[model samples]
Target chain A: MTLASPLAALGRPVLAALAALGRVAIYAGQTFGALFSKPFYTREFLSSLLHVGWLSLPVVGLTAIFTGGALALQIYAGGQRFSAEAVVPQIVAIGMVRELGPVLVGLMIAARVTSSIAAEIATMKVTEQIDALVTLSTNPLKYLTLPRVLAGTLTVPLLVAVGDIIGIMGGFLVATGQLGFNKATYIQNTLDFLEGADVVSSLVKGAVFGFIATLIGCYHGMASGRGAMGVGGATKTAVAAASVLILAANFLLTSVMFGS
Target chain B: MIELANVTKSFGSNHVLRGVNLIVPKGQSMVVIGGSGTGKSVLLKCVLGLVRPDQGLITLDGQDVAKAEREAFLARFGMLFQGGALFDSLKVWENVAFRLLRGPLKRPKAEARAIAIEKLRRVGLVPETADLFPAELSGGMQKRVGLARAIAAEPEIIFFDEPTTGLDPIMAGVINDLIREIVSEMGATAITITHDMTSVRAIADRVAMLHGGVIRWTGPVKEMDVTSDPYVQQFIHGRATGPIAAVR
Candidate 1:
């Protein structure tokens, strides 16, 4: 039955998007359930941790350092107009811990880990390795999705914490060298300005972004269509979805944690 | 024994399985042959509980497989996929012993590796091949590794999906002979889905022809040549024009 209504033109794609969202939510729920279930694949978990966490450090660290340095320079220029140059240390600390650190780490993960995970698992599905896992009496969700999700959720926070430190240090280096701030005074102000809640919020944002990135990767991989184009499309969609969701999640988390 | 009664499955506008009914008896090799997209693989998956049928019943040894305890039910079956589908991340031995190293079939690490090596040898691969990854092997070698993985647990029921697809004639012949010998030696019930007549002749104790989602014919292999059904006749003789309607 064809509808004469103009809304019909927009109906199918919107419905498909909603349906895809529904499937991802269900998949996420099942993965969470699998987390507590038996036959937990420790071997898969550790290997995934190594891949999604340890291997991702260099990219996240490099992104953070550069971003922090750039942020300090921009803030310094803007501060000059208002004669607020004395606020560099405090501003840099707050910026790194509260916003740039988690967001940058999350986006880096979306670029590095999400695409790789999606490509690897989508290839596995294409080759029937996933079906083979089923025949071998192994739950693919338990063996594949849960470990990657757990590793991402647990490790990205730590990555964010490390990134926060490195980013703040980058700002300090730039401020002390180019901006002529006193090293001792900058360090003291940075330490004095950062509260425990700031650290907590950064770690919490990291954890949430990590979950979003990894879960989207696994979801796209599992729900991929058939053949090479299917896998390629899935890999692309995973990164895009992870990036967008990381930003959206960051906004939601920020509002809840700091808006009040 | 496995049975599918009035099973039906469809994907949107496509009707893949339509009221299909068939029975595979114990301790015998049953091969189902059909053109591409005839739902042979879907039927196989339905029995394995990989794809749930939209309607009808599938039973293994008279018990519904869908309702059986998943781990115990799957432990009884092994399947060799169309492609080798070996885990590229792991060594060949690790792929072979994947089942043995985890879940209900868990074995000690050394024991699993040893058994994997033994199974590899049984499929004509040397112990040296065990350390290489699947990507390092030729297509034929990867298929042999898949065969090794299939039999690693010595499952009571084995399903081979297009076992000889994508192989040269010589390699296909070798795989067919190996399958016949191994299945006979293991005394396991086997179901192989393939359009390769050579494989059917070499492996099937019984033949079932599937077309339009139902069994068009079923009988002993000796009578496959004599089957009067037009679909069976066309498929066996490789005819483009028949009741099977290739383009439609």
Candidate 2:
């Protein structure tokens, strides 16, 4: 078969990209409009809380414990090169409270919750359940998206707080047991080094990340194309979008909180 | 009453509903029949305001339904979806009493559950079935539960999208009879979209055939068998040699 010229070869990709971008724009508009609409799904919202909040605690807690332990060891090792080993306690405390805990939990939620939400909603849309909702005098967005979004916004900050404490505790365990640091001294140093600003910043990051994760999931799921293939594509897109947006927002939040 | 005038819906280059116009009188059952991908579901969705038509007017009782108050218009109707569409998280009673337990019609849970059980019983379901989830029900039972939910609020209009698509012949017949009985007893205008001719015979007072994104033939079900419309004849007969092409 003869190959197409370079100009012709570029056309398909360009058109595909534009089409994708157009779909994203439409999804954003639909979600934004739905956000303000009335007859919100209160039952769906409460149910989403059970899904996004209560169901997520164990994983978030486990992740925090391991991450905090690893982080303490890494900080101690790096601090030793400059004879700054004693700084490990302070660094681990500040880092867990201000940065790693919320960011990691946000990323985890983006991976787990965002993908599930996207897949579930996309499947419903593909199967015409969304249409069924409309015909039943229900607004799909109000009945679907708002609840998920609200649950994320409310629960994620609480998750971040739990994760932060667990992470710090992990660091404490590692510092005292494995690193041979004095337990009381390590705890005292951690408490002395951390401030309200660090905790507040982490919680703020949690809220922002939660919003991003749910928004991406809702956006991709609502704009999902037809059939199983469409739902799979939506799940992939939602996870990717949530992950990228979480990281970017983490960076922006960190800078705004600490750069000053 | 519902009327669609010159309604058109297109997806990019694919025109799904092409200037389709039809009318359903008040408190009557109308079945729209067509093969898959022929825009039968799309037409129902347009009338339900799920899909916005590119051009035309949809009116209910002389009021412009397409531009009507969304909530007010939607509250007037109920829909039984193709796959039942019950929420998996809710028990059978919760699903049936969905409207009664929430929003504008919020009732006490006990009261709603009682009504739900009553409605479930009306659909030939046992009271014990109310405690089960949608996932626990068989396909036929799930359809019955959906029918119960549709009639729970005694809607003025009801839309049934493929109400018998996945059921056995016996179950399908049961559902068709239930739909017919419910619509007539409640004096509700009913619109059903299906490819099943048996369903059309059992549930529809009038039959409209959709082909190539438009209404090909629309008249009383009594007239459908005798109509000279090639599309309807080929469709109802399941023939491959007429204007309709066989699936490759």
Candidate 3:
């Protein structure tokens, strides 16, 4: 068989990507319009906060702690190569507070919460429950998407803050115990390196990531195709989209916050 | 009253509905019957504005349904889905009283639960089932719960989409009977879509046979057996070899 030209091989994938992007744009437009329309679901939003935020604390806390510990060790080893081991506590504290904590929490939520929301909503759409909601005079966007998005927006920053504190503590533990740094000095150094700007930047990143995660989940879920296979595909797509967007947004936010 | 005029819907190259027209007067039960993928459900969805018609006008009480104020228009309708789509996260009572518990019609939780339990009882469900999650209920029980929720808000128009698809014959009959009683008692206009002849006979005051993207025959239920339309005869008789191809 003769080999196809490079252009032909790339045509299908490019067209498919453009189609996907168009669909996403449509979903975003619908979601944004519905969010401001009548019959807002405040109770659903509060309940979703409890479900997505309060219930997610334990996992976020554990992940942050372990990540902080590992970062401290790695930073300590790397610093020694340049005779900069004295910078371990400060570097770990600044990194955890400004980047790792929020990014990690956002990725974790994309894996857990985004997948669950997408699967649940996609199943509802496939099974015609969303139609039922429409017949009952309830807007699915108001009833379903608003609550989850509101919950994500409000709760994610709090989770990130909690994660940041826990991570810094983890770094402190490693610095003081394993690396033979004086406990008080390590604590003081970490405190000195961490500024209000770092905390604010992390929270801002958390909010953006949270919005992207829930938006992707809701969009994919609402637009899912028919059957069990459709729901599964939507769940996978939602998580993947949310994770990638979170990382990209993290980089953009970091640049804006510190690159000047 | 609900009316669909020249409604057409298609998914890409597949045409699901082709200028279908139908009318159901106020408080009348209009059962739409057809084989699967014949656009029966799509017709009902078009009227409810769930699936927008490519070319058509849907009117409720002479107001264009497609352009009607959505929330007010929807408030007048209820629906029972094929799968009894109760929220798995909510208690049975909350699912039943979903509308009454929030929005402009918000009521006290206790009062909503009381109404939910009462509606559940009307459908032959026990009060104890109110606190249980949907997953804990049997298939028959879930259908009954769905019926309860459908009637909870006392909507003026109720749409039942395959309300008896998966239940046993006995249970299906029970649901059909319940649907008939509830629609009559509430004096609500009803539109039901089903392939089940039993549901057609039990719940429909007038039956409309949808085939080939349009209504093939429409008349009183008593006339269904005597219809000369080959499509109707083929469909109601479940004949594989007929004027209507079986491949669809």
Top TM-score hit: 1
Q: List the residue pairs that clash in candidate 3.
A: none
Worst 10 residues of 3 chain A by lDDT: A1-10
Answer with 1 or 2, whichever has the higher DockQ: 1
Residue ranges of candidate 1 with Cα displaced over 4 Å: A1-15
Comparing 1 with 3 on DockQ, the higher-scoring candidate is 1
- DockQ scores of all models, one per candidate: 0.91, 0.60, 0.74
Stronger candidate by lDDT (1 vs 2): 1
| C-alpha RMSD in Å of predicted model 3 compared with the true structure | 2.2
Please list the residue runs of candidate 3 whose C-alpha ends up more than 4 Å from where it truly belongs after superposition: A1-38
After the best TM-score superposition of candidate 1, give how far the Cα of residue B122 lies from its true spot, in angstroms: 0.4
Measured over all alpha carbons after superposition, the RMSD of each candidate to the real structure, in angstroms, is 1.5, 3.0, 2.2
TM-score of chain B of each: 0.99, 0.98, 0.98
What is model 1's native contact fraction? 1.00
- Candidate 1 lDDT by residue in tens digits, B68-174: 99999999998999998899999999999999999878999999999999999999999999999999999999999999999999999999999999999999998
Give the top-scoring candidate (lDDT). Answer: 1
Model 2 C-alpha lDDT per residue in residues A19-135, reported as the tens digit of each score: 876876675567668768676777688888998888999999999999999999999999999999899889988888888988999998998899999999898888777776776
lDDT by residue (A134-183, candidate 3, tens digit) is 77667788889988987898899999999999998898888888999999
Q: After superposition, how far is residue A64 of candidate 1 from its true place, in Å?
A: 0.6
